[model samples]
Target: MLLSVNNITIAFKSKKVVENLSFSVDRGQSLGIVGESGSGKSATALAIMGLLPPTGRVTEGTIELDGTDLLTLLRNQENYRGRKIGMIFQEPMSSLNPLFTCGYQIKETVLQHQAVTARQAEAQLTSLLEEVQLTRQLGERYPHQLSGGQLQRMMIAIALAGNPDLLIADEPTTALDVTVQAAILELLNKLRRSRNMALIFISHDLSVVRQVSDHLVVMYRGRCVESSSVAEVFSHPRHPYTRGLLACRPRPHLRLLYLPTVKDYMEERPDGTIVEKMPDNPLLGATRGSYSPSQFDPLLKVENLTVSYQNQINVLHSVSFEVFPGETLGIVGESGSGKTTIARTIVGLLPLKSGKIYFQNYLLGKARPRSVTRQIQMIFQDPQGSLNPRMTIGEALMEPLHIHRLYSSRSERRQAVIDLLTKVGLEPDILSFYPYAFSGGQKQRISIARALIVRPSLVIADEAVSALDVSVQAQVLNLLKSLQQQFNLTYLFISHDLAVVKFMSDRILVMYRGKIEEQGIADQIYQQPQSEYTKQLIQSIPQYV
Candidate 1:
């Protein structure tokens, strides 16, 4: 075995996070660690690399690289950190230095491990970028200048600078477009074979893990619930959590009226024994959206909408679309496809150069009225950035009410906030906690509550559930559907995920390079796409084997 971890226990400040975990990987083999957030997958990677924080440590067990104890190397300070093992972090934007160019950063890494001069390091840097299917010209740009896929490629180049035998990738393809994600996976597998490198791939998305992994390890809360070959686990899941993960993803074949969550399958008793139950009937009364645009007048109309950046570069060009009442319009494309710009334009965040926007048949000028503003609200991609860290949940939810002057008294507004919290599956007592205290899924729920508190007519959800785990994503999607039915809401949903967009939208709009490629009924578009761009997007979606 190239790497072996036996009976390992990891802890932070004397509190155990990963207990009795064990796994192994051979040369030219890949082991996938599948779990949600806080499942201890990343912690195990850190322990193997000897990169744990000061408060964290390996409390017991052994980590061996080719039969050499890793813990002993750490104590001796002669470790094989960059020389024999490399790691690609989850978020490249945070891991890379913004002040330096990509080429400079990678060159530095190459120089650290190799006894090469500056000129020789430059040659190696060029070769690394080429190996990852990136251009050398892109190397001179800063991290922000590169797209999501390009940045990930740059990170791979840096990790390969050491020419290590093992690579640990933590959620490497999360939140990327489907095509970009597929390309990155292919690149990783290619590099692994060319170099005979062992890999530890970590992710919350099971479909993604299925594409690259040889063996699978399913984790929940800090324990490995199931371990087996990838095909065996998918064919017959022994653990309830594993079954839940497999059944929760949005399938491209059809739409489920209500997606099943993990809690619907099992429950843990007070004594720590698990009780299994039959999964909820996800296909009961499963139906597709039947809204007809010809019946009702358009709720929102955009004609010749165009938006430009501060540098006078147009990101959106002559875009036009209409959203009918009580229907969802899904917009999908890759990065730089103006999917987000259209959402910002509808919500009055950007100024149009020459176009007309009519909400409720009222023309929206450069300066929108308060009535128009209250009727249109937006949910951003990153819930953590959208919320205020210092404000309590109660205060954050009530601020919109205060601005709109909806309720008569402060007490009435407080009650309204509590009611909204309950609707979103959160307790009233959590109002006292700050945003940082909640998990990613919980924070997204809070964001949803804050958006719906004002009772808006149109809700623009922009990549809202892309960052969530499959099970949490199912819960949130179901919640959104329920809320839509109860409130008679209209959603202008935007996502790069084709399957998700298919599930949520009545009509689909394909956007490519700031232009609308095609728009039609959701089912028709998915079954027989007219445009090559739409077909390509659908083909890029990862399929389970």
Candidate 2:
């Protein structure tokens, strides 16, 4: 085996995150770790890379690279990191230093382990960029100047600078669009084949992992629930969790029933004990409560909206849509297709170059007061970036309320924060915790709570659930559905995940290059797409049996 993890256990403080998880990857082979959010996939990779935070430690286990125990190595071990192992993280924006040029960053990694002058390092950096399928000129660009896919490729170049035998990529393609994701996966596959390097690809999408991984390990609650060859596992999944995950992915020509998650059937007893019951499938439930088109009026209406950046090209062009109360309008497109720009324009973060926005028949485009901003709330794509890391969850939640002056009394404000947490399926005690302390899923839940604190008439979720796992995504989607029903709230749900959009959206709008290529009922669009872009998007979605 090129890399082997035997009986490994990792812990954060006193809580175990990965317990006795054993896996091995042969030379030139790919192994995948699949699981839901907080399932220890990334934690396991961190432990293997000797990059765990101070609070997290490898409690027990042997991480061996070709029979050399990596866990026993000291930080100063000369050949451990650069020569034997390399890692690529999930978010390129966070992983790359904003202050450095791409070439400098790559050169730094190469020079850290080798004796090389600046001139030689520059030459090596150019070759590294070429190896990662990027043009040499791009090396001079700052991280922010590069697109998401280009940034990810730069990260790969940095990871490979040392020519490590093993590469650990943790959700490397999660933030990319479908076409970009396929390209990255293809790049990784080609690199692995050519270099004979072992790869540990960690992600929640089974279909994606299956395409690149030869072997698969299904993880849940820090345990290896199932392990098999990708073909065998996908064909006949043994564990319930694995089956549920596979079933959750949107499949072409297959109508997916909403699969039950571990949380749905399990509830706390009156005495604070947990018990499991037969799971209730929400999608299979009676259609008796189906939404009617006439129940509520349009909460938000946009007509011929157009927006452009400062002294730049137009990003959104003549877009028009209405979000009715208690309805979800899904905007689907690739990255930089103006999906987010549209959301930002509607929420008043960006000025309309040309257009009209109406909320409750009031012209929002002309409104200048802060009161108009209170009725429209937006949840960003990256929860961590959107949230203030310095503030605790309670403080973050309370800031919106304070700004809007929703509550005057301290007691009432405290109660409101607690209620918001409960509404989002988080414990009230978590209110005192900071954003950095929470997992990706928890941070997103906090983001949702913050958006709902002011009780806005319309909420724009901009790729809100894309960072989450399948199970957590389902729960959050169901929560949004229930919340909309209870509060009569309208949602402008934006995402790249068609399955998620299909599950939550009443109407779907497909956009390409800042234009709405197609718009219709969600079911109709998915079942019979007319536009070529929509057809390609539907076809590109990963399929599962």
Candidate 3:
């Protein structure tokens, strides 16, 4: 084995994060460690690299690399990082330095690992970028200048600078669109095969992990519940946790009324044994719902909508669409494809170059009225970023009610807040807690509650569930659907995930490079995509087979 982790236990301070975890990878083989947040997959990766935080320690077992003890190297202050093992982190934007150019950063890594001159390192950096399928011109630009895929490629180029034997990818493609993700996965496999490198792929998405890894390890809370070949695991998942992970993700081929979560598949005893439960039939034939634009008056209309940044570059060009009163009009595209720009423009966050927006037949100008603001609320991609960290949930939810001046008394507003909390599957007791006290899923629920508190007729959800785990994403998507039905809410949903967009949208709009590529019924768009971009997006979706 190239790398072996035998009965390892990882802990931070007095608390155990990972217990009795065992896995191995041979040369030129890929091992996938799959789990959601707080499942200790990343902890195992960190332990192998000796990069754990100050409070964390390898409490038990052994980690061996090429028959050499990894802990011994750490204790002796010997460098195995970059020389023998390299890692690609989850978020490329945060992992890379923003101050320097991509070439400079990559060259610095090359110099640190290998004995090379400055000019030699620069030459090597260019070769690495080429190997990762990135252009040399992009290397001269800063991190922000690149797209999500480009940044990830740059990260891979840096990781490959050392020419390590083992590569650890920790959620490398989590933030990327389907097309970009497919490209990255292909590139990684190509590199691994050509270089004969052992790979440890870690991700929450089993479909993505299956594409890159030969073996699979399913984790829950801190234990390795199941380990087997990728094909075996997918064909016959033994653990309820594994089954839940497999079933939770939205599938392009299947339209489910409600995506099943981990909780729906199993109940965990206090002693930690799992009891499997029978899941309901969630399949919906053909489509979720049907809607034609001519059926009802348009709730929102955008005519010749054009938006530019600093009057030099046009981000949205002559975009036009109409949203019915009770249907979801999903906009699907990659980053910088003008998805969020449309949402932001309607919410009065950006200055349009030339356009006319009508909400309820009333023209919306640059500065919207208080009434318009109350009725057209937005849920952003990152819930934590949108919410105030210092403010309590009650204070955050009630701020909108206070601004709109709904309900006469403070007691009425409090009750309204409580009701909204309950509507979003949260408790009234959480009103006293701050945003930091909640998990990513809980924060997103709070964001949803805050958006719906004002009784918005039209809600713009921009990548709202993109960052959530598959199970949490299922819950959030179901909640959105239920809330929409109950409140008669109209959604202008925007996301890069096509399966999710297909599930939630009545009609779909495919966008590419600031232009509408295709727009039609949700089923038609998926089953019969006309444009090459749309077809590419659909084909890029990871297949179960």
* TM-score on alpha carbons, each prediction: 0.97, 0.86, 0.97
- Residue 340 of model 2 has an lDDT of 92
Residues 1-545 of candidate 3: C-alpha lDDT, one tens digit per residue: 89999999999999999999999998899999999999999999999999999999999999999898798776653367987899999999999999999999999999999989999998998899899999899999999999999999999999999999999999999999999999999999999999999999999989899999999999999999999999999999999999888877887776567777888788999997889988754542223544555677899999999999999999999999999998999999999899999999999999899989999999999778899888999999999899998899999999999989999998999999998888889999998999999999999999999999999999999999999988899889989998998999999999999989988888899999999999998888999999999999999888766
The alpha-carbon RMSD values of the candidates against the true structure, listed in the order shown, are 1.5, 3.8, 1.6
Cα deviation at 142, candidate 3, in Å, is 1.8
In model 2, the clashing pairs are: none
Stretches off by above 4 angstroms in model 2 are 11-15, 53-59, 72-76, 107-127, 250-259, 264-298, 366-373, 384-421, 427-438
Candidate 2 vs candidate 3: which has greater lDDT?
Answer: 3
Give the number of colliding residue pairs in candidate 1: 0
Q: lDDT: which candidate is best?
A: 3
Model 3 scores a TM of 0.97
Q: What does the lDDT come to for candidate 2?
A: 0.84
lDDT of each: 0.91, 0.84, 0.91
Backbone clashes in model 2 = 0
Worst 10 residues of 1 by lDDT: 283-292
Q: Is candidate 1 or candidate 2 better by TM-score?
A: 1
Question: How much is 259 displaced in model 2, in angstroms?
Answer: 5.3
